[model samples]
Target: LMVLGLIGAVVLASGSLIKAISMIILGLLLGQINTDVISGTPRYSFDIPELTDGIGFVVIAMGVFGFGEIIANLGMPAEHREVFTKKVKGLWPTKEDFKEAWPAVLRGTGIGSLLGVLPGGGALLASFAAYTLEKKVAKDPSKFGRGAIQGVAGPESANNAGAQTSFIPMLTLGIPPNAVMALMVGAMTIKGIQPGPQVMSSNPTLFWGLIASMWVGNLMLVILNLPLIGIWIKLLTVPYRFLFPAIVVFCCIGTYTLNNSSFDVYMTALFAVIGYVFYKLKCEPAPLLLGFILGPMMEENLRRALLLSRGDWSTFATRPLSAGLLIAAAIMIITVILPGISGKREAAFQEAD
Candidate 1:
């Protein structure tokens, strides 16, 4: 938990979502190599039998995101609570607000669509990036944390676009970018459908129908959610003592159902304590969850790439596409290190209001 917590701390400190994600991938790859193929001996196992099977990503996610959220919320003071004001504003945006928001939504949707195609890039990253991008482009950036219209419109559109496009990789390329995609891949298998390029040709109706359904579902969600917005706002005003326990119970039940294992529940409790410590230390858990998911998969792919390249390290730099991606990654890292870059980034988030 502590190791994962450290990863999360680094991710939050880096101030670049993409940079943190890439680092998590690299870290997972590092943790994944368990055996020396030539020597035929366990390499990072430290003689622990459980280490051979590796850590469970589900456990980590439940601990970091599920329990962690509960702990963090518990630590917050009552004065920090946010409540909806009784003041009435029209449901529709003003003309100036619409003018500012429409372009932001379009840009966010485009960014979300493009990034959602990449492995490990999905709705969460897209939402964060979209919000950051909107703030960067806003004339009065100080209005953001203070209920800026662009902040809401941009991220909401980006998240929707990302949620839709994230399926492209799994449906077209047989690659699951995140855990949800992994589940979708399982669903395809259960339906006797191969998830690849042939899926489009062999299951054209299912493919096109799924795409059409996304549009219909999106429309329906808007229609359904608008009326329920007031209900959700009311939920926010519920006392923390009552609300937190309900959240805890739901999480515990969900975790138990994951494998019908009481061990998982116990582990969640342990993680909740760890998460509370993290809250006290002011560390974030998002990166840790990302790392926990990517670690084993990254190790497998890295090993395969090395084997295919005959262990040639230069393979990464020699391949045109790989080289280009590496260069882009390097530039991102350089930007993070340059003076004032980190400061300005933090300032944007700090001055969100």
Candidate 2:
């Protein structure tokens, strides 16, 4: 009991510290610095003036990072001897593939829609959970990871569904689901809008209109993706030589536009380089991203909870829910590294072989 208490305390402290640091670093990277506090500090220098409010982070993250990935993906030589360079398959799902995937799609959508409403996490978790669920419910249970339709369908639907529905709690309740929500609130504040429980009652049109637009936008996405599927398929058939450079160029331009500073372009390229290294290392970026986003909130909560507890440190364990989560996290950390860690994954791979 004593050892568990100590381990919990250390783990909680470390996680909170990391979260605080990440939030502060991300805020700086995105230009969310409040100058009033820093103006008096002689050592502090405002790097980018345009980052006065910090909304540019999402645009750059999406546009520039996305473009870089597209470019790199295009660079894998066509007809070359590389896993990522394999020839394109039939664009339309084959009958067998469709038969396998249809059920997983339905299941993933149902699970993801609910997970997205939770105020504490992001679509990343929803996607991971979707993948896990698909594997469990699969009739054959061996169709995963080998160009399985369900593998693609479940995560795609979950991520997309989560993207739209995540706005439910954010806009209506004014409680953030993830870092993006926090950034959205920051953006709203810049626009002279206030968020809270009353905002829904006070601004019915703004709230309802946002919700309505999401439905319309989702419909448009389906319509656009349907006709354009063929075009995108044709694009995949094109050789890598022409496509790769274009991707790199677009990413560079998008990154540069964020702060209108060349430094950010360089910074983006640096991260891209790191991304490629990570690709080689087989390190998952999902956790890294989640860690980065959660880093700040964790710190704030730890401090607030502790201060309220008068530094008792027992508050975390004293609260039933928090204690339960902390224990689960400990068990997960232990299980992830044990020999059984890769048992299922290895079995899956052998089946693939």
Candidate 3:
């Protein structure tokens, strides 16, 4: 819960720009923050000379690994790519398929538009919820998870639509819709733009231009992804000997761009090693990312809540919403721990269906 709260705080703080770069840099550092499988343990300490709270580790790792990956990709021969680069499939969705997709797209758009206004909204959530809703809303519910066209349409559209709309809050209100947006806010602040409702009033060009660009960007993504999806799929079919280097190069370019420091590249390589190790060990990386990203902010919020309650422990359980959230957390924890116990509840739903 503490880690979750911290993640929430970071999400609320970081608005939706530079999501890619931050994900690369900060993500790597998070891998180093606490190697322990479990968070909130006193086993880890912040006494390391090089790792003063994991941010440096993240930056360094990002630079090295990202650059290394790019270098590796660049090393691949074009002649070798020719062996696998077959002609791609069609660029457009069929008219019948489009008909199947439109409703899901509409619903997803509605959900994303609403979610976009809220701070800390995530594209993944919008996508997942849209997917789940589509599953429920479909006439043939069983067709989903089996390449149903609507399943692909709604969540894909919603997540993209949500991602695009999330910029509105950052542009209009100066409040970040997510961590990426928060970084954008930082960049804007650095550029002497005070974000608020008045942003439109003061700089109609920036506001409107950005809005226009999003639609343009969507068009661009379609043009790019349609041809590239075939390519992406093709890459999977290519020999592993060629693929691993491409992965290394992609990581390197993305990571090195963070601060242009070679140290950051090396740091990224280090994290990649750690990530590989984690994969081998069968430990979950999701929680680690959540913990490292949210740790500092979580501590701040906990202290603030404590202050509000005059250091009373009961405050967490006393507030109506807070108490409800806590109860929900407990339910989630127990459900994950003992899913078998909920077998009857699951069967009841199946029977209801």
Residue-level lDDT tens digits of model 3 in 234-312: 7656765667667667666766676665655666666666555443443323334433444444455667788788999
lDDT (CA) per prediction: 0.68, 0.57, 0.58
Cand. 2 Cα-lDDT: 0.57
Model 1 whole-model lDDT (C-alpha atoms): 0.68
Question: Per-residue error at 257 for model 2, in Å?
Answer: 2.1
Q: What does the lDDT come to for candidate 3?
A: 0.58
Q: What's model 2's lDDT at 315? A: 81
TM-scores for the candidates: 0.72, 0.64, 0.55
Cα misplacement distance, residue 236 of candidate 3 (Å):
4.5
lDDT of 1 by residue, 149-182 (tens): 8989988888889888989989889999877899
What candidate 2 gets wrong by more than 4 Å, as runs, is 1-78, 81-95, 103-111, 114-121, 124-148, 176-214, 337-353
The 10 consecutive residues of candidate 3 with the worst lDDT sum are 9-18
Candidate 3: where is the Cα deviation over 4 Å? 1-50, 53-162, 168-173, 177-193, 197-212, 227-238, 281-284, 337-353
TM-score-better candidate, 1 vs 3: 1
- Give per-residue CA lDDT, model 2, range 1-47, as digits (tens): 21232232222211122332343344333332323322432222356
The ten-residue window of minimal lDDT in model 2 covers 6-15
